[model samples]
Target chain A: MIDLKRDGDVFVLRFDAGENRFHPDFIDAVGVALDEVERTEGPGALVTVGTGKFYSNGLDLEWLGANRDRFEEYLRTVNALYARFLSLPVPTVAALNGHAFAGGAMLALAHDFAVMRTDRGYFCLPEVDLGMSFTPGMSALIQARLTAPVAHEAMLTGRRYTAAEAQAAGIVARTAAEDQVLPAALELAASLAPKDGKVVGKIRTDMYAGTLAALRGPVF
Target chain B: MIDLKRDGDVFVLRFDAGENRFHPDFIDAVGVALDEVERTEGPGALVTVGTGKFYSNGLDLEWLGANRDRFEEYLRTVNALYARFLSLPVPTVAALNGHAFAGGAMLALAHDFAVMRTDRGYFCLPEVDLGMSFTPGMSALIQARLTAPVAHEAMLTGRRYTAAEAQAAGIVARTAAEDQVLPAALELAASLAPKDGKVVGKIRTDMYAGTLAALRGPVF
Candidate 1:
C-alpha cells in the first residue's frame, strides 16, 4: 500500500511492507507522490519513505518467479511509477527507511537526493539472477547518475550492502540515525524548497537528459 | 579511422587518432568494436582505447564548437554509438589512453569497466560549461552509473579530475602508466574472457541488473 502526506512544503511518500506481502508497483506510488507534491504543495521539494522494515525488497521474487505471466506487467507498472517521479518538476529526497532491494533501489535513485538510514538498512538488485536484462530505460537512469566501476560492480554482482557501504559508493546522500531519516529529509526538502524553482528544475531536467543519452547510446 | 583488429580471443578496439584528428563520431566507432567483439569473439568482454595522448579531448572542441549544424549530427551519431555499446550482448572494457574529457568521459562510462591512466589522465563531462547541457542520453548514462553529487559536480561545474582522483572517486578501474593502459586492459580482458560465455554473461548481466536494483533501484 502507499501513503502520502504533507507537512508545510515537504510532502512525504511512504509505503507498507508486510510479512510475505511485497509488490513492485509501489515504485509507481512514488510517482503518485511526486504528482501530489507538485499539484498540492506547489513547486517544492518532497521526501520518500517506507513504513516499518524496508524501503522495499523489489520484485517479490518468490511470487514473481512462480507467477511469471505478470512479469511484463510488473515491469511496465514499475517503469511508469519511476517515469512519473523523474518527470516531476521539483526536487525530491528519498529517505530510505530500511533495506531497498532491486526495484526498491531504482525508486531511491529516482529522487533528486537520498538520505539513507544507518540502522539495518541496506541495498541490492538481483534481477540478473533471474535471467532478464535491465531495460534500456533503467540503464539510462543509473548509468547517468552513478560512477563506472561502482555502477558496474553493483550491477554485475547484484551484491547487497549496508547503508555505510552505499554511502561510500557515493549514492546515499547522508547516513542518519534511524530516527533522523524523515527529519533529515524534511530539512533537506525545506532547504531546497526556497531555492529558485525554475533553475532547480532546469538543472535537474538537463542533467537527466544528458546522461540518458550516454546509457542508451552504444550497446545497452 | 577506427582500428578493429584481433589478438587471440581479445579483440583490440582503438581510437585511430590519425594525424591527431578525431571524428566526432568516435563514439560509434567504439560501438562497431563492441559488435565485432560480440560477433566474432562471442558474448564476453572487450577493451576500448585511444591511440594518442587522449582517450578523447572531445569534439575536437575547436572543430565541433565551430561547426554548429554538424554538431547536432555528431551528437546523434555518438548517441547511437553509446547506445549500441550499452545494448551489446557482453560486458565491455575501456582503456583510457590519457585524458577522457567531455564526451570522452561519457564514453568511458559506457563500458562495463574502465582502466584509466592515473598520472596524466583525467575525466569530466563539461558540456554545461559550453553553454549547453549534455543531451538527455549523456546525462542519464552518467546518472545511472555514477553517484549524484559526483555526476552533477562534473556535469554542472564541468570540472576535470586527475586519474588518481578519478580512481578515488571510483571512475577508472585501475590507473597505470599511460603505456601500461592497453596492457592492463588486455590482461583484464583476457582474464575476463574464456569464462563460461553463458555463465559469465549471466553473472555480468545479473551483476548489473540485480546490483542496480539492490543498490539504487530503477530510476535515473
Candidate 2:
C-alpha cells in the first residue's frame, strides 16, 4: 500500500491504502521506504502524498481495538516515526490530497514543509472533542511546529482548518488545486534537494532537540 | 527605573532606564511591579513599554563584568522573571518602542501578544553572532512562540528583523507607527481584560507545562 518512487532528486512516497491509517504493517512499510530514501547517495529530498479521498485519517482504531495490549508499544513506535521524519537527513514535504486528521495531521507537521489541496480536505486535531488529552510527546511536537496562539486554539478547540486557513495560520507552507498538490510539493522539494543533507539534518536535530527528547522519552 | 500605572483595567509598566538592560536592581524593580499587577482584582491585564530608543537590550554585560561570580544566580533570576510573565494570571502584551534584542526579545515572546513600532527599530537575537548559545529555557521559549521555520531561521542566522518582517514571521501580533505602539498594545490588552484571569492562567500553565518546567529547572 506504500509506493516509493524516484522523480529526479525527489523520492515520492505515496500511500494508496484507503484512509491510510497507521496500521502496524503500514508503519513498517513506510519505515522500510524511509530506509531506502535515507541511503540516497547525494542531492535528495522526499515528498509524501496519498491517493484519492484521504491523505490519512490517523490511527487505526479498529486495529487498536483488536490489539489493546500493544497500545503503549504502538504509540511508542508512532512517536519514533514522528521523530525520525522530523530529523530526516533530506528535506521532506507532505502533499495532502485530502483529509489529514489527528495523528495524520501531525505526520504532515513532522515534515519540513507541506502543500495542501486548496479545493478540498481539512487539517484537524479532534482529541479534545474525543475526550482525550495529548501525550507529552505529541504536545511537544505540536507546540514545536506551530506558533503559540495557533497551537493554543487548535489544541484547545480542535478546529478543522481548510487549506487556505491552514496556510494563513502557518500550519501549511502552500496550497494548490487537487491535481497540482503533489506537483507543487515535488517542485518545492526538488528546489531544496541541492542543500547538503547532513547539514540540514544536523540543523533540524539541534533546532528541535527538546522535541526529539520528548518524543524519545516515556509516553506517560 | 520601572513605572507601573493603572490605566482602566490595564496596568501599564514602563521601563525608563537607558537601554533597559537586566541589572539586578532593574530585575528587582520589575519583579515588584509584577507583584502589584498580580494583586490586581477583578478584570485586569498588563502592557509593558520602554522609553526612547530601547525596549530592552537584554543582559547587563557591563554589570556582569564586575560581578562575575553572580552569573548563574543572575541568569536564574532572569529566567524566573520570564517564567512569571509567561504564566501571569492575566493577559499580557509587550509594546516594543524600539529594539528588543537577545533576552529582551525573549521577554516579548513571554507575553501573550506584542505590538512593535514599525519604524526605526529592530527585533533580533544576536547570540549566535556573539559566540553564545541559548540556555535550554530560552531555546524552549523561542521555539514555543514561533512557527518552526521562523524559529529555525532566527536561531541559526541571528537575523535582525524589522517590525514588518517580524509581524509577517509571526514574531509580533501587530505593528504600528512609532507614536502608536503603546496605544496599540494597550488596546489589545484592554480588549482581553475581561477574560476570567484564573481560567486564562490555568490554561496557559497547562499548555506550557514543559516550558515552565524548563524555565524553572537548572540553567545549565
Candidate 3:
C-alpha cells in the first residue's frame, strides 16, 4: 500500500508494499497519495521512500508478462508517474533506503534531491543488461539530470553504484546510514519548505521543459 | 589576441589578452577564433584556456563607462558570445587557470566541464555587491547550470569561491594547481573527443532549452 503522512510541513510518502513495483494497484494508490498531498493545506515539501531491502524493482515484470496486451497503456502510466514527480509543485526528495534499479532509478532522478543509505543499497539502471533500451523520454530525463560522462556510463554499463560512489559521482545529494535516510531527506525537505511552492514549481517547469515535453509526448 | 590551435582532435582556444575582458574588439577576436575552430575539419572537442592572472575579468567596465550609448548593443554581443559557447557543436571544457569573475564565471559554467587552479585566484559572481541584479537571461543560465541552493548562495552572496570550495559546491568539475589546470582540462577534452560532436551538441541544446531561450530572447 502507499502510505502518506504529514510531519510538520513535510509529507512522507512511503511505498509499504514489498518491492514497490509499478503494478496497476500500486500506481493508483500512489496517484491518490500524490493528489492528497497536492490538495493539502500546509505541506511544503514531499519525500518518497520505501521499506525493506528493495526501494523499488521498477516495472512489474510479472504483471506485464501476464498482460502483454496492455504494455502500451502501462508505459503511459509509468511516464505519467515520472512526469508528476519531475514537476511536483514543491521541493521533493528521494530517500533511497534500499536498491533502486531500472525505472526505479528514473523515479529517484525525478526528485530534486536524493539521500541514500550508505551501508547498503545500490542505484542502477539495468536496461542494457535486460536487453531493453531507453525511450526518448527516459533518455531525455537521464540526460537532463546527469552530466555527460556519468549519464553515458550509467546508461551503457548498468553499473550498480554504491552510496559513496553515487555521492562522489553527483548522483545523490547526500548519504546516511540505513536508519537515517528518511530523517535526512525530511530534514532537507523541511529546510527548503518556506519557499513559495508555485514559484519553485514554475522554475522547475521552465528549467526542465524539454525533458517534460518528451516525457509527456506520445508514447509511440 | 584570441588564439586557436588544433591539438589533434581537440581545438584549444586561448585568450591571451590581459584580463581578457569583454571589449568589442576582444569579442570580435574571440568570435573569429570560434569560427576558425568551427570551420576546422575533424575537431572533436574544444578547450578554452587563458594566459594571465585572470582567466577573464568579465565585462570591460572602463570601455562600457566611456561608451554608454553602446550598452544595449554590447549586452546583445555578450549574450551572443555566451549562447555560441553554450551550443558549440563540440564538447567543451573551460580551463580556469586564474580568477573568473562575473561573466567569466558564467562562461566557465557554460562549458561541459571546468578545471580550475587550486592555489590562487577565485571564482565569483559579484553582481549583488556591485549594486546590480542579474537579468532574467543571466539568472536562468545560472539556475540551469547549478543546483538551486548552490546557485542561490553564489548569486545572492556573491561569494568568492576558492578552488576547493568551488569544486565541493559543484561550481567547477575539478581543481588542480595553477600549473596543472590547463593540462587537466585538455586531458578531459581529449578523452571525450572520440564521441560524435553532433550528438553531444544536440543533447546540450535540448538539455538547456529554457536557459538558451531566455539568453537568446529580447534583451530588454
Q: Top model by DockQ, which number? A: 1
Alpha-carbon deviation at B119 in model 1, angstroms: 5.8
* Cα lDDT tens digits for candidate 1, B1-220: 6787776677777777742234655554655666567766453566778877777666566677578667767666666565555545555678988778876787788677788886676787767777867666666667756667778687788788887888776677777887888999888777666544444465444334433332222221
Return the DockQ of model 1.
0.16
Total backbone collisions for each predicted model: 78, 0, 0
Model 3: per-residue lDDT, tens digit, B123-149? 999999999776677788888777778
Question: What TM-score fits each model?
Answer: 0.56, 0.61, 0.66
DockQ score of each predicted structure, in the order shown:
0.16, 0.13, 0.06
User: How high is each candidate's interface RMSD, in Å?
Assistant: 5.4, 4.8, 6.4
lDDT of 1: 0.68
Better of 2 and 3 by DockQ: 2
| Candidate number that wins on lDDT, 2 or 3 | 2
Kindly indicate the candidate among 1 and 3 with the higher lDDT. 3
Candidate 2, B1-220: lDDT as tens digits: 9999999999999999999999999999999999998997899999999999999999999999999999889888889989999899999999999999999999999999999999889999877556566767887888878877788667655679999999999999999999999999999999999998889999998999988988888876
Candidate achieving the largest lDDT? 2
Candidate 2 chain B weakest ten by summed lDDT: B127-136
Tell me what TM-score chain B of candidate 1 gets against the true chain B. 0.80
Encode model 2's per-residue lDDT on A191-212: one tens digit a residue: 7787667766765676788899
